[model samples]
Target: MDALIEKLKGQIIEQLNLVEVKPADIKPDAPLFGEGLGLDSIDALELIVLLEKHYGIKIQNPADGKKIFESVRTMAEFIKSNGKD
Candidate 1:
């Protein structure tokens, strides 16, 4: 799980084009949106693309993204639960 989270931090930075953010800078439990990463709606769309492109996991319900993307940990958990990792 820790490895997945670390991999996710790099993937998130790359996917979101967060040039100023490093993988080490992202906390596992940090929120991906709002006050945490300051990501907006468009970034959320990018994340969905990231999951599909990298993990082969398609998010069927947009509403579930809010919970799944709560943090890197949550995202990793979702991916693992879906047997994507």
Candidate 2:
């Protein structure tokens, strides 16, 4: 799933328009929201849509989303384990 992490990192950075931050800069354990990346609700929505669009997986509930989106590692695992692609 290393390739999936790389791709997700790239997508996150790209979709969020995070200037000056490369995909390599993001740590797998670093939280994507709150104090870690300072991302907000909108960013979370973007990420959810991104996952669905790219991985063919639909996050039906926001509660589950929080668990799956805890970090880069979590997101990659979530997508890989739950994604249809």
Candidate 3:
């Protein structure tokens, strides 16, 4: 899980183009799409695609998207449980 989290952090940093932040700077439980990391709706869409593209996990329901994207920890857990990797 730790390895997966680190890899996902790197992917997030690259995909989001988070110029000012480092992977280690991201708290696992940090709010990734708002006050904590300051991402917006478009970034959320990117993250959703990222989960599908990289992890081979598709979130069909928008409501499930909320639970899946709450934080890095949550995303990691989702991927770990459901990812093709």
The lDDT, on a scale of 0 to 1, for candidate 1 is 0.92
Candidate 1 stretches with Cα past 4 Å from truth are none
Candidate No. with top lDDT = 1
lDDT: the better of candidates 1 and 2 = 1
**lDDT tens digits, residues 45-67, model 3?**
88988987887777787568778
* Number of the top-ranking candidate, with TM-score as the measure: 1
The TM-score of predicted model 1 comes to 0.96
Per-residue lDDT tens digits for candidate 1, residues 1-50, read 99999999999999998999988889899888878577999999889999
Alpha-carbon local distance difference test for all models: 0.92, 0.83, 0.84
Which residue runs of candidate 2 sit more than 4 Å off their true CA positions? 83-85
Q: Which window of 10 residues has the lowest lDDT sum in candidate 3?
A: 76-85
TM-score of each: 0.96, 0.89, 0.89
Task: Please list all clashing residue pairs in model 3, or write none if there are none.
Answer: none
Estimate the Cα RMSD of every predicted model relative to the unseen true structure. Answer: 0.8, 1.3, 1.3
* 1 against 2, candidate with superior TM-score: 1
For model 2, how does the per-residue alpha-carbon lDDT over 1-85 read when each residue is reduced to its tens digit? 7888888898888888888888878998888878857789989888888887888787788778788889989999987677443
